[model samples]
Target: MSESEKAARLSVFKTYKLFVGGKFPRSESGRVYEVTDSKGRWLANAPQSSRKDARDAVVAARKAFAGWSGATAYNRGQILYRVAEMLEGRRDQFVREVGDAEGLSKSKAGAVVDAAIDRWVWYAGWTDKIAQIVGGANPVAGPYFNLSSPEPTGVVAILAPQESSFLGLVSVVAPVIATGNTAVVVTSEASPLPALSLGEVLATSDLPGGVVNLLSGRTAEIATPLAAHQDVNAIDLAGAEEVLAKELEIAAADNLKRVRRPQPVDWAADPGTERLTSFLETKTVWHPAGGSGSSGAAY
Candidate 1:
């Protein structure tokens, strides 16, 4: 082995801790699952994330919702950008882990990792600005002046897409939090190692506690409870099967949570700014615009 390669091996990843309430802790259930590389070689132990664990995460997310959503848009934008900076700094480690788990060549893994990291930068740029595009004043048939603007739905539950593990996961989470919404992401089951690594990235990022929760377990197992949780304001079924998606949709209807169904995605196709629009609600405002008395100048 080359000198640098030997050093890398010596410093290979240890089993990571779950990020909950801005702290790294082992799963509340005290269970750990064996994570393996593509060739079936053991890599590390990932948290055997549980139902109780999921519920705990939900509590954290709900607790952080008010502050995260109420944070100034400009400040949120800057914090989101900090995540991109941290990810960029750790690109090599991510590429290595993704390559090992997905069995891709180093170059291919690097490209995928780079794309995922860049997606955050793109979303960060949108946090403060997309509001202007998605909301605006409209000329209504009324005497009072009228205006409209967007506000975030609180505490989103996300089923992160399985196909593009890191990128898809980040895509859903970034947009949800970018608009001041807190989230809990159910990470990819088969390839959850990357998700754990991502938790490490977030622990270092300047994000507030509970703003984003990462849980790696059966999506079917955990998603049902979250979908039905009355406190959860919205659901993004961006990665669930039709049956699972339908079930979530039905549960969401009980509280009328804003549900974004999974589309047949063509990865090459542009996801565009649709994600930003999903977390927003338009509120129309009106007030009297009458003129002051013209005779006041006589004084």
Candidate 2:
């Protein structure tokens, strides 16, 4: 064969973009940063998200909260399962990204990607069952029906873990949405491509627009405002450092955002119900019951 015939075709570069409200858009700031593979080879220019981008994501998540939270548990479970399906369909792409992002061998990256997909399936099963597990009836001295249930706390801000980028990101984000809370995720600063690509999967799944908005940029830059935003109902500082986590916690307190402090974890390990309950709020409801009076008033 001639030398020209033996040459490989040039690969088409993919432009990595931010995912917000189920659409891919360039950063509102009109800026981009070069992403590289583990060996320092050029990958693509990922969006450099801004503070306004963070705020916008919060708004999108807020708008999506009611519908998502109001959806039937069975329906939500199916939707989450659909995410797993989409992830499975795009397995090879994620395998490549994970391998490049985490500097793992192709085999190791495939394992990680497989784990992430299974994690989604795990959370999917929890949607219908969690409320029954965490909520129940209580006996009271008065003639009333007292019941408590876990409810979505509205929009949540998440800092995806820095290491184990894809699996960790899925671990954090899945539970939040599985329990009906919408999310604004700030992907790992060092390895954001996988997280950004996951957004594409979410959009293609049956999930509603604005349900899970993702941003890729400085973690603190995006997390700080989300912590303080009044509309935000919770914050997960999984990716923040000691000093930064402390600062974000303080900011979260301004509006009493339910904060999940950073803790070391094996993202590949079996995640129990804690993450599902972490972002949920228990609501106790009381209804008068059972007594008939001669005065024609019944309780």
Candidate 3:
């Protein structure tokens, strides 16, 4: 190596884009923000998504919901498992990003990455089995057969946890889609690289476009409209502060959206099916057990 002949070349920086509708697009507003590592080293410019972008994501999610929700549960499970597989293939990339974004030791970052992958796998298995566990035949006094089952509530907006970037992002996103709900996620404002990279994995994992859209920007800016939007079916405020969560919950009432308030959560802990159930709607059907069954169905 020389000065001119033994000189080190400048490193090439990566430009991170937003993941929407299975496509990598610059923010329609052409806005971007500097994303820095924990040490304040410049990493890249991430898309500073706008409200129009949020609306576009919601539109895409709503458009894709019927097909995704109607797909066989086994197929959905396979697609989710494929997300885990894709993440595994790109393990080192995530480890590096996690370490940089969260300022964790390599081992700690690796553990976070591992936990994220496992979280996807866990939710994958739940796709096909949730209906069975949350629903069943009801015993009635009348001669009627009654049964209940879970159904997706349609497009969901997720505010991903700000602290535990990778693990928290995975924990919030996986369960929403596991039970057939499509989502538009607002990633952590401070550390969104891993979540942005996750869009690449999801794009290749056979998940339908728009089934899961990820945005990187201010949470309140993006989450407010989603909470108030008449089209959105639910809003998960898992990552908001108490006051902000309360405000968004009240806004969600504008459209009667299913609202999930923030709870004390440890992303590393075992998360049961609560997340899955939060966005699900129960449907019950009743039918007379006897006679010709003409105009005899029970309400």
Candidate 4:
């Protein structure tokens, strides 16, 4: 090809931005940092999120929580299933991004992408059934009936795992939304492209805006404000280093936020109900039993 034809063949680069309030916005700080492949090759620039960005995410999540949590369990299941469908259609793109992010061979990356998609499906199936598994009637004396129900714990901030970017991210995030809680996710600092790309898929899916917010930046810088934010009800430090997790845990204590500390995880293993149950709060109601004509007091 001649130089003129070659110039016309130049590829258009993509600008990676934070997914906040279901919209792609540059960081409030208007700062960006270099994102490189695992081999140190320049890839793209990702927005370096700031404390203000973190707060914005919390506001978005909080705004989305009531509607999301109020939706029927079956409806949440349908939306999560839709997410899986969208991911399946974009399988190839995720395979490429995961491969570059983790320095994996194409075949290995394909397996990870498959696992992530399947993880979404797995969580989708649990949406309607989780309450049954965790909640039920309780045995009580004195002609009183008691029952327990699981409720969403409002806004949850999740730190996506550093190494297993796609699969680990899916693991932490899918369960949160599937169970009717909105999330503010901090993607893998070193490998955030896949997570950011996933945001596009979510936007197109039927999920409400702000149900899942994605932030790409220095993990510690973004996590600090989220951990301390009064609006955030829970935090999952899945990607934090030991010291950082401990510090964030302490910060979360200020408002008695539910904390899930970082732990060594096998992303390929079948994730049990632990993640689903972590962000749930059990609400038990007691009612006095009486005849149909009698007034019954409930508490």
lDDT (10s digit) by residue, model 2, range 95-156: 99999998999999999999999999999999999989999998999888999999998899
lDDT of each: 0.83, 0.92, 0.93, 0.94
How do all the candidates rank in terms of lDDT, highest first?
4, 3, 2, 1
lDDT of 1 by residue, 213-279 (tens): 8887677877988898888889999889999999989988989899999987654345688898898
Cα lDDT tens digits for candidate 4, 151-235:
9998999999999989999999999998899999999999999999999999999999999999999999999999999889999
- RMSD (Cα, Å) of model 3: 2.8
Strongest candidate by lDDT: 4
Runs off by more than 4 Å, candidate 2: 1-8, 295-299
Clashing pairs in 1: none
Residue 160 Cα positional deviation in candidate 1, in Å, after optimal superposition: 0.9
Q: TM per model?
A: 0.90, 0.95, 0.94, 0.95
Cα TM-score of candidate 2: 0.95
lDDT at 50, model 1? 78
Local accuracy of candidate 3 as per-residue lDDT tens digits, 146-254: 9999999999999999988899999999999999999999999989999999999999999999999999988888888888888999999987888889989999998
